[model samples]
Target: MKYVFDWEAFGGCLGMLVVLALIPIGAFVVYFIFNAILFILPAIVAGAIILAIPVGLFYAFKEMVFKKVE
Candidate 1:
């Protein structure tokens, strides 16, 4: 009987381990990005709403004044 060390099998196993290790890391990154967007989304929407109110009022007044002028 002869003993043989299979380098190809070892390399394949090592590659699989690396890929498995990266899966959780990739999932965590995706989760963090999603959570950050969720956290910021309300603030972004509120800011837009707050700014829109003033801009809308300004445009309404401008149209009213311009209509009276013409």
Candidate 2:
């Protein structure tokens, strides 16, 4: 008796296994990215606000001091 190997079926099963393996890895990648953005967004916003306040005050004071009365 001789046995025959089916390349097509093997390839299909291999592809399915690879796809299944990637699902968890892809989920973790997305999860980490989302968490990182959430963690960093507040710091970015706080820094922007902190920098803006000083610049805004300087501009406000400049306008008040330099404006001429008509």
Candidate 3:
């Protein structure tokens, strides 16, 4: 059976998806030489931290601040 529609929630999700799709546009606009270097260095550092950190704490905080244990 099909669930009844909620247009408001659908519209909100569509808006979020549109905003997310704009991220690559911003990335492309940042391809200028100096700006590219500026962005790339920090991204490398952040990636290193992701790889360096311990697995459990890394994934937990990366996803959310407080995760409950059952």
Candidate 4:
């Protein structure tokens, strides 16, 4: 019978554990910070466009009726 301890195998197993543990945490962080913003970006742009519409109409009305060139 022979007893042996393999440092390389132990280090590789530890590295794999760290990587596996980090993957889900990394995914969550990326989703919340980056991908989630990307997902909402279209809605944000749409809101800006919606907000601009009323201001545009107001400007158009002012030019048509209030801006009197006499």
Candidate 5:
């Protein structure tokens, strides 16, 4: 007995394969954007904290450490 190939089913499977290939690419782009945002968030928070520390140190020095002896 010989088997027959169904062109319509083959074409549908091909199309589905193409769609499946694209799914990972789309998901990768989305995942990269999300992780990039997550990574940048900590850097932004760290920068803010670092900036505040100097300002606070300067304010404390002026207020308490360096006093006018009059």
Candidate 6:
């Protein structure tokens, strides 16, 4: 006995194979995006702290050292 060629079934199988191959590539892209977010969040927090410290010190000096004048 001989088998017949089935183009539809073959095409479906090929499509599935391509989808399976892409899964890992998608995962790598997602992983890098999360890493970029992780790095950016810390830099933003550090920037806010760096800005706050100066303003806080100025207020402290005005309240403490200049208390007698006011």
Question: Against the true structure, whose lDDT is highest?
Answer: 2
Q: Give one digit per residue, the lDDT tens place, for model 4 in 1-70.
A: 4335456655655565465456555555566777776646554555565576567546643344333334
| Lowest lDDT 10-residue stretch of candidate 5 | 61-70
Candidate 1 whole-model C-alpha lDDT, 0 to 1: 0.53
Q: What's the count of clashing pairs in each model shown? A: 0, 0, 0, 0, 0, 0
Per residue, candidate 5 scores C-alpha lDDT tens digits across 1-70 of 4345456655655565465456445545655777866556555555565566567556643444333444
Predicted structure 3: lDDT: 0.52
For 1-70, candidate 3 gives per-residue lDDT tens digits of: 3345456655655575466455555554555535766677555555555464456344543334333344
Give each model a TM-score: 0.41, 0.38, 0.43, 0.36, 0.43, 0.42
Clashes of 6: 0
**lDDT values, one for every candidate:** 0.53, 0.55, 0.52, 0.54, 0.54, 0.54
* Candidate 6, 1-70: lDDT as tens digits: 4345456655655575466456545555655777766655555555565576557546643444332321
| TM-score, model 3 to reference | 0.43
TM-score of predicted structure 1: 0.41
Off by over 4 Å in 2: 1-4, 36-70
In model 1, state the lDDT of residue 47: 52
State the lDDT of candidate 1 residue by residue for 1-50, as single tens digits: 43454566556555754654565455556557777656455555555655
By TM-score, the better pick of 5 and 6 is: 5
Off by over 4 Å in 5: 36-70
Query: Which residue window of length 10 is worst by lDDT in model 2?
Result: 61-70
For residue 14, what is the lDDT in candidate 6? Answer: 58
lDDT of 4 at 70: 40
Give the better candidate number (1 or 5) by lDDT: 5
The total number of steric clashes, by the backbone 3 Å criterion, in model 1 comes to: 0
